[model samples]
Target: MMRVGAVAAMLRAGAAVSLSEPELLGLAEHVRPGAVCFDIGAAYGMYTYPLARLAGPAGQVHSFEPLPVPYRILEAGWRAIGARNVRVTNAALSSSTGYQRLRLPYRFGLPIHGWAHLEEGLKHPGSSAAARIVEVPVYTVDRVCELRELPRVDFIKMDVEGYEAEVLKGAEWTIEQHRPALLLEIEDRHLGKYGRDSAEVAGSLLARGYRMHVWHRGRWNRADRVSTRWRNYLFVSWAAERRR
Candidate 1:
């Protein structure tokens, strides 16, 4: 069932700053009416809020943010924006369903890397900010869909720090079921933090018959494999094995 509670959210530019990730342009451009979108790790509803607008009344957006503060902000944003089709949930998407110890950031902290930046701040010590570690519930896309009774997802955007692999792992069933396009953040430092390689992430998707593409230097390029930049990437799930 959809978690019921008061969540925090904010409205920016009236455009929904929650959907403010850099990689979504490619996916946003192709959005259609009645489309169903999922924004995993949706911090503060930047992606989720705007997507709720894009999808319009006919389309729907399922936004998941587990971090206590972020999840609250997401909920608030939904209420502030008042999109009838938007659904916000307080949970995380992962390769498995369980609890995970996560690093908490100092006030106004900037990520030294990706979502795993809290861990980096701890290891580096030279970081200007301090962090606290906390444990929270984790779940997978498949589990979320099953719990919410959602059948199809048109687009899936994930930015789970360095845990993209784990998120994809839990999404195997959903990937096969919805076959939606994916826009994920895959940086070398982030992947390295989790000891995962791009080949595994990219190869796994390719093997599943999803077409791959990458956003490079402001242009969207359809790549046969993962991009070399490793900063951020967009993986489009095409209908066939037409990898390019």
Candidate 2:
């Protein structure tokens, strides 16, 4: 049976800031039974629960959330559903291991919970939306793997605002060693706010021999160029032996 309450309500409502059911379903297509998956920027466990279910009892799902509010909700939801294979971490993954300020903005008299980001600028700089700054622990994917003694990583789904490049930089070792499939969101405007660019992000992955594909309408389409419009992309490592 599914759990009840706010988390379940949110899941049932299917109200996610930048995620859609089709996208989530497409992501699940990449996961295999007993796979080890990482859910970065896992707000309220929206993708975490589904990922855990996909991974199955023998698999594991590590969910990372920096914001306290969402982290708590994520934890609660995980327990509510009795998901034994999901591990929740209240930290942000970045290019380095340390603490960083996360900017959160409010909208319609309430926090726009999912918009909180570590991109160095507020999404609504001069708008009426209230802003909250919080210092959250940060870890590199390499460090996380080492500390947790993770055996292997099969897939990673990241939606860290525009900090995707930085996160990838930190996960270089893990990516090289495990060659996990990647699902990331790329927004040129958001990257530009922090002196980064989408082209650079895509180029870095391509340099590592990962083929890029765009996710749309519940399917994967090969993308040779980066578009300005915000959307999720799937990067499959050439070294990956498993095929879908």
Candidate 3:
């Protein structure tokens, strides 16, 4: 069961709370019915639920969340909503398959659970305490697709704190093969903690023929270069763009 307070807070906010960005919801509209989607770092099924709903019953949604607390909340929410096509996985996606320690931070006696990352040294914003390290199973996108026999992924929404680069590395094969449209969050400051930069992150996609666009004031603006500030980016594959 989810903490009563948390559940209430979610209910109060409704769909708007989960799909915080207008661009994300707009992107979801692009997913046709019966498309397969992946929601990385799907905390509490916010975006997951909306994506699943948009995909409809014929489609499938695979969501990944490593932390136990949020994972439980996410699973229960799916069950409560009777989302049959949504599969919630209690694992983190990374560059390799195996177990890794996730450092979760605390603030004001409450866990800043969503900010937890695979990098041990990374720090969360706001006043924090010693991190609670939890062992979590990790899977690469390729590994998961191979193991689960997933259909060609049509879209992916990835927001794994600062570990987006590592996750992209793991999904390289999937990206090359599927050329799925991507909604990625970039926080250069957080990436710096993992010895990564925005250019390196954006370069990974650009090298694979992805055009980068940033969401601003309800519209997507093409970005020739990745900025240092934290923001969300839409990476459309060249092939997909051509089709559009």
TM of each candidate vs. truth: 0.77, 0.86, 0.87
Off by over 4 Å in 2: 1-19, 119-129, 228-230, 241-244
lDDT of 2 by residue, 1-244 (tens): 2432233345434633343444665655678779999999998776787777677788889999999998998888788778888899999999898889988888766887766788443343334358888999999888989998999998999989888878998999999999999988888766765667788989999999998887665477878768865377889976662455
Q: Residue-wise lDDT of candidate 1 within 1-244, one digit each (tens)?
A: 0111112122223223424444544445655678888888788765776566566678888887767777787688677657678888776667778777676556566532124332321223234466666676777888878888886777888887767777888888888877778877766555666667777877888787766666556467777656555455655666532443
- lDDT of candidate 1? 0.66
Lowest summed lDDT across 10 adjacent residues in model 1 is found at: 1-10
lDDT of 3 at 200: 91
lDDT tens readout by residue for model 3, 136-167:
99999999899989879888899898899889
Clash count per candidate: 15, 0, 0
Model 3, stretches more than 4 Å misplaced?
1-19, 120-128, 228-230
Give candidate 1 misplaced runs (Cα > 4 Å): 1-22, 107-130, 216-219, 228-230, 240-244
User: Would you list the rank order by TM-score, best first?
Assistant: 3, 2, 1
- Which has the better TM-score: candidate 1, or candidate 2? 2
| Clash list (residue pairs), candidate 3 | none
Candidate 3 lands at a TM-score of 0.87
